[model samples]
Target: MKAKNDAPLRSRQLIGYFVFSILLNGFGNGLTVAMNLGSALWTASAVNLAHALHLTLLTVLLAEGVAVVLFNALVLRRLEWRRIAGNFIFMIPFSFLVSWFAQLIGMTPLVALPLMWRVVLDLFGIVCTGVAVSIYQRLNVMLHPNDDLMQILRFHFLHGNAALAQPLSFVPPITLILICVLATRQAYALNIGTLFSLVAQGAIVGLADRVVFPQLKHRHLVV
Candidate 1:
């Protein structure tokens, strides 16, 4: 039903949406830092390694990015250079927003607040992360290499069955979490935020589909 020439315009629109989603993801990351706890699974693993190896968090994150690219290339049996480039490009804005938001909207003022307040902040982060990820998934456009690999595995190997896709997608991050937990012997290697992110992924996506996406459509923010 779509015209052929619409492809280019649609592609550009998807790219724009993807960029916006990544920025929200970055804000979510900053909020996680503000919570003074471990972030989502992948980031928690990276943080664990950063502390143990005495390396900068960004350096370890870049290593993880490269590993993801290699894994995607292997699984898909093709080198998507655009995905490779996207990893680099997304990291730039992601890292910047994380740092900027951490300072601008940090939890510093809430140091004296109760645990419930911090929990509220973390929940907000979860919402941001959940909505951003949901939008990204719905767009069915370009993704970071790590996410692309997960989607590929979900679609190709799992036949797009969400039950299979969900558990299987956790493999990489869980592996990283275990490795860090065993290496560091930290009881909190996987903190509440990370665990919640994993468990609530489905709910979050559903919320976005039912609630957030409609708002975007009504506002003509995404097409």
Candidate 2:
């Protein structure tokens, strides 16, 4: 069935999932910023670009969301304006939450922490990202626009070739970060976390999809 045509889940239930997902996302973002490194590949690129352009990270994310929506519309030959708009609206709260969490964590203090603790935070961030992404996928309301773009690229553009599509989705984002880093002479955007996310996010998400989503499905708690 077309995603647009699917019936809406109960409002209360869906909202609960949304809240939980956003919290995870916000916390993960906090850890990323606190570690003074990239937590996710696409995020790294977006953050770097935002820095280079002297724009707020939220602004860059919103722009990227719009671009993804446009790209999806072009490829699908149909515009799901509601989904696009929903995702765009979702970004505002997400940005604020991330900012709040980032501030709450106190980046300066986090950076000054011992190296072992920093590694722990990085791992925690990755886990948060993995679980949050998985829950978001199961909720089936609206995707974090770029995620939807990645799906479209994987299924529509790559024709279900996971091998190619998976890596393709990551390469551009990391490459963008690399370019900006070299040009601006700023290495903050690319770090151990970036490499960790590139390698581990897939495994983590895959495990969640295989193990977590199934349990949620069994409980009839998710669509």
Considering every candidate listed, which one attains the maximal TM-score?
A: 2
| Per-model CA lDDT versus the true structure | 0.64, 0.69
Q: Candidate 1: where are CA atoms >4 Å away? A: 1-16, 103-107, 161-167, 187-189, 214-223
Q: RMSD for each model, in Å, please?
A: 4.9, 3.9
Task: Extract clashing residue pairs from model 2.
Answer: none
Error of model 1, residue 86, in angstroms: 2.4
lDDT (tens digit, per residue) of candidate 1 on 150-207: 5566556865444355446668877876777688787333557776777775467556
Error of 1 at 57 (Å): 1.5
Off by over 4 Å in 2: 1-10, 154-166, 217-223
Error of 1 at 85 (Å): 2.3
Q: Deviation in angstroms for 22 in model 1?
A: 1.7
